[model samples]
Target: MFGYVIKRHQLWSGKVLLFPLSSSCASGASGVRFVFGRASAAGTERRTAPAESTGQGEAMYRRKMRGMYISKRALRKHFDPHNYPRETYLLCELQWRGSHKFWQHWLRNDDSKDCHAEKYFLEEIFEPRSYNICDMTWYLSWSPCGECCDIIQDFLEEQPNVNINIRVARLYYTDRASNRKGLRELASSPGVTLEIMDAEDYNYCWETFIQPGVYYRFSPENFESAIKRNCSQLDDILQGLHL
Candidate 1:
């Protein structure tokens, strides 16, 4: 969201990196560790290229970023196991061809058919490149749906040079088998790294996107615990059949 990328670096280093899928943890790569100055975020934003303000880039930095910002209260509502909006929003940062591009999108209605946010990024915003390395970090309001999982899978399969690191604000219908299967499959994907957003991520998104240069805000009383609970649920999705 606010700060970084290291697609499945945890897969490389024995360290947990951001989220823990298991109890076993150890350190490995130094460069990967160095980039993540704090928590799951990169120390500095990799904006080698400026983000577009016009056209399809959705460069409404504060304008749309604020409009798209998810509040802690909203996180509690949608992050709950029993309730959630039937929508998705993605805060994505991509480092490609020595440039960093940022974009955000939500599901769009095109002639009655739902167009997912992921589609905009995968199909519209960025072109496929097989030469240089591409690292993507996504802060999703909701985890990718089963259908989206398949879509993301196909997309990643094609872009062998692309690597994705995802952190979701909430788990999406993990009670449903199809969603869980898709999520687990994604976790197992070669170049994919998935984790539930924790307090650090919450702060990172806020500072980087919503209110840069502002003082850090305090979280709700239950917010930290809620994150732990959701993280446990995510670990379960990747580690077990139950959510």
Candidate 2:
């Protein structure tokens, strides 16, 4: 229990409530998510939150959202092979394939009680607003674990229209056989494309998601070897799984 308050009414079955990741999101505006927990132990399905509107209070809301990126220094600390962050973060964009409420939002498991950011996306966001043709892109601070892979696979199976391009900053638990196997299976999915985040991707994420002019980019000397290392492992994971 993270001791967070549940502001939204639970409209769907699941464990945790996912509204107001910040107090600003309580207004329920577009792009603001209102997520409930995953399906219950007895088989209740979970639901995701929609982003508070990007309309009226757009500027202020952006500040609130952008603040979550923490700082440039924080981003750099975890890229090292000897020191990776325990938490996972997801920044996603749903394009014009009918994933409206999810439009562009970020989620992180570090702050949540019992779920990763991906669980919120799968259960609450994508599950409720599935479309005939879904095209989305994601930037994940860490690749998913084995369980989330199964869940993602199921989601794609049911919603054959949902397609994802996941660019992860680092591979999660590559030392574990199960995690690698799970990623390999996930890479085999027809609708998912998994790749390591390169410097360009990091630059894009910083430019797009972080608050503007607040943090300076690190020197090119940073994270270069880490990126190469992660990329090599990702290629190995997906070597023969690509369709």
lDDT of each: 0.54, 0.57
- Give candidate 1 regions above 4 Å deviation: 1-83, 97-112, 211-221
For model 1, the run of ten residues with the poorest summed lDDT? 24-33
lDDT tens per residue, model 2, 14-65: 3433344444222211122331222101111122234222321111112222
Positional deviation of 13 in candidate 1, in angstroms? 39
Cα error, residue 122 of model 1, in Å, equals 1.1
TM-score for each of the candidates: 0.61, 0.66
- The C-alpha stretches of model 2 lying farther than 4 A from their native spots are 1-82, 98-102, 110-112, 127-131, 240-243
Q: What is the C-alpha lDDT profile of model 1 across 18-91, one tens digit per residue?
A: 33222111111101111212223321222234332222221111211124444444444543434567656565
TM-score of 2: 0.66
Model 2's number of clashes is 24
lDDT score for residue 215 of model 1? 50
